[model samples]
Target: MSEGRHEDESQTRPSGISTDVEVGAAHAIQPPRLENGEKRTDTEADGQNDQVELGSSGRNTTQEKPYSVFSTNEKRIIILAGSLAGFFSPLTSSIYFPALGTIAKALHVSNSDVNLTVTTYLILQGLAPMVIAGFADNMGRRPAYMLCFTIYICANLGLGLQNSYAALLGLRCLQSAGSSGTIALANGLVGDTITSEQRGAYIAFASLGGLLGPTLSPIIGGLISQNLEWHWLFWFLLIFSGVFTVPLFLFLPETCRKIVGDGSIPPPPLNTSLTDVIRHKRRAKRGLVFDAAEQAELRKNYRFRFPNPLATLWILFDPASLVILVATGLNLACFYAISTGASAAFRDEYGFNDIQIGLVFIPIGVGGILAAFTTGKLVDWNYQRHAQRLGITVVKGVRQDLTDFPIETARIQVALPILLANGVFVIAYGWTVGHKISLAGPIIFLFFLGYCSIASYQVMNVLMTDLWPGQAAAATAANNFIRCELGAAASAAIGPMSKAFGQGWAYTFWALIYMAFAPALLIISRRGIQMRSAKKAREDKRSARRKEKMNRKG
Candidate 1:
């Protein structure tokens, strides 16, 4: 699904709207045209261009829009802001693990009751992002971002101060709702600004904060929870949100294509920074203002769209999209299941204490960070290699018509060998722990597991963004939803599986079953371009039927 495309409906026009298909692109990669029943207009004739560039992605390339490449500094800042935003969810989720027992003791709740909040958190973490992302996709990025952070701040404050089990349950749900939007919004911002050619590095940077958070949070939480009271965890979140997230979000200008209509259109006043607002106030005091056309342009562009959860979930119906979602989710689940079982296994098998078990987890985090950076570079490199080998002229700012490139081969193919190696580590790690081998064995395998799993997972993520360029938020929300569900399920089952079958057999089940993804990878890598073409065709046919019915009714 190499759909490096844009939603031209969101592009600004002189009439404040644009037509769907390019007027005269006979071979252009575009939505299927209405059947040619009427004579063509001379205006349409005049619009034809002789530029016939080839792209194997099966879409016509003639009608694609050219975009401005942001300067290095601007790119860095956008990724930085997005990465900071990405950090909050995992931080909020992981930092609480060390404090759960303390929290239960302070609130005088049963262990089971305390564990229920974790489940509640995971469930909301899966679902809330769907609703929040709808707004990010439809309305604007900045407002949605502000909304999520505000909810997060409030939830953290309440959790820190509250002393009831019921309050504990509710606040964690609220916290999950708020924090979960960061990854979706971060992906949206990156998609909004960067072209697919150069997006890999930026996606790595945007995701780095998420990887860093979970890795550091437990160690930090353990230290804080052991020394201070558990309430300080939320206090730390509150201060961090206030000091870091709020100021950065306030200064971050809106970047959604639906709202701003690409770089050519000026951003709305509200989307601008506090400095811009002050400058505007000063200008107004001096009686300076926009002319008639400018004012009318603002009026035309201003719109409010309510969130639609269904729309976010609908992408799963696409076969290629669904397969990618499930595979990535399960791969993520592998990590979650293993990590959740790690501490108990360490304690029982090696006689290690809580702090030692937590310390051993650091290598997994390091592996994740290393995987993101290294995989990002490899993804970009692979994309270019595929492009050149296929003879597509690689353009930096221009979205390449991926019609010709086998993107699955480019993104995921390179990672397959790595994944096979990862499976071996998965089996070995399980056996190592089960056999109570040297401590170094499990650590080494866990590190490799993190590296290989993340590398493959990152490829899937990049491919997803490319497949649904204009709907990055919804697509990401869907991805996150699947991963969380799988994570929860896998986390729950790991203990049972281990208890029932023993660690060696339990993880051997995982290793053998992982081969199931091979068929999906083959299907997607081979069939993605055809699936995309067929889906577009079906969409066009349905649209034509609807329009014909409307005409007859009229």
Candidate 2:
């Protein structure tokens, strides 16, 4: 390699190496020869070029940004906080189901009437995140988190105290609003803290909250309702919210990249770590002092602004994003629908009590969790494997590009079989349940059902984060919005469809629905390169324009 700077005024464009440089900066790497056979940098001094270039030594060097500022423990704590934050609404909703009959009887309402509350909760779950995600993405994750927790804590207290049916309905909606955004925020935090190559495992771990919530809900609810009063359920949630809220308020650092800038940039004082603050206070009490300048340096980079939720429309409208979103959304709907109908179907056919019915959900939860953890590791491994094969250098701790790296295949190809196999499990579960087979029959498939259902979500989620790491909160919120809306629909319809079509045929239809979306993944994997290239080109053009405008201003 040889060093050169572009100095020839006659050379106006790039020769084999044109890139949008900073305003007032000259090209650092001139081509070996121009198109007309002239050297552009043959007679130039160092000039005004601020860019660095390869030295005559021929050693390639790149200054790469470190992955994040937070320590490994800090990262785990962040993930833990995120998982706990996300665990509420779904778990609460499912847990509340066990108490539904008890509540209806105590309140002098029909069971059917109480079920409407579930519908309203799910609806609000879908709608609330539409606006709430903006607060996390644009405003600040900390404020958004505080706001949601405030609402959830208050709503749970209300639900516990309220004797009227309307209160239950309204409070449930409020609770949904408070809790549903946790998944989106958790996802955003992952984008904020983790690099693209490592996001899969982190995402899978974060998603476990959602998976465990519904899975554990019934068991907790059944025991509470079976032995104690029904209102204790809400009381329990209220206590749980308060307990979780303290750690979040005290220890959780704001990880929104828009405000924090990947931990390299310090966020505002408000976004500083509660744990750090507490440690500082305790240290000061012991006559110890730390460097104020060091503390101040971190927060100086902090900024605040309203993040637009509508910005997510860019990812949502993107063909690649849209396809994956739909696939995951529909797949989750099946999970919700099956969960909804499973209670009643099992109760009616097997003569199982509420506790026994709740136990049935454990297999799915266990399976889904196993899949999530395993899939995450595999996602990272698969990425490395693909990157190696594609000759894409993944410099350790640096976020590198795979623009032409066939990431679609790396992300989806292996997961495709896992996805397609899920449908088979669904159909099997349906038939087994329809025929009233042995208990182990349907339960075994539920495990696999849980396993396969989340494979696409885990894979696609990491991809979405990779696609737009900056606005990850917004992107995830859009995904949550899509899937929750679909889940609401499935939750509402599963029971009726089961009775109308018979479980066997009804599940067959759902199986086919999942299978129908498989082709979309295939198409996306094939065409993803072109899509990403066009996107990169557009971004490059924009960069060029911005730089040119800056130069004019200078």
CA deviation > 4 Å runs, candidate 1: 1-66, 100-115, 275-302
* Model 1 TM: 0.83
Q: Mind giving the per-residue lDDT tens digits that candidate 2 earns over 65-138?
A: 24344555667778878877888967887897666667888999976677678777878876677667767755
Q: How far is 264's C-alpha from truth in model 1 (Å)? A: 3.3
Cα-based lDDT at residue 487, candidate 2: 79
- Cα lDDT of all candidates, in order? 0.68, 0.68
State the lDDT of candidate 1 residue by residue for 1-554, as single tens digits.
11111343322211111122111112223332321212221111112232334545576544333342234565567778887887998888777665656676788885446656766777788888898887776567788888898999999999889888898899999999999988888888877777676667665677787788768877777777878877888999999898887577667766676554433244575567663365446545665442344334434545766677775667777778788888787777777767666755776799765456657668778888898888888877777776556544553344434454466667767666776677777789989999999989999998888788878777787788777776777778888898888777766677778889888877777766665674577788887667767766776676689789999999
Quote each prediction's TM-score.
0.83, 0.82
Off by over 4 Å in 2: 1-63, 108-112, 276-308, 538-554
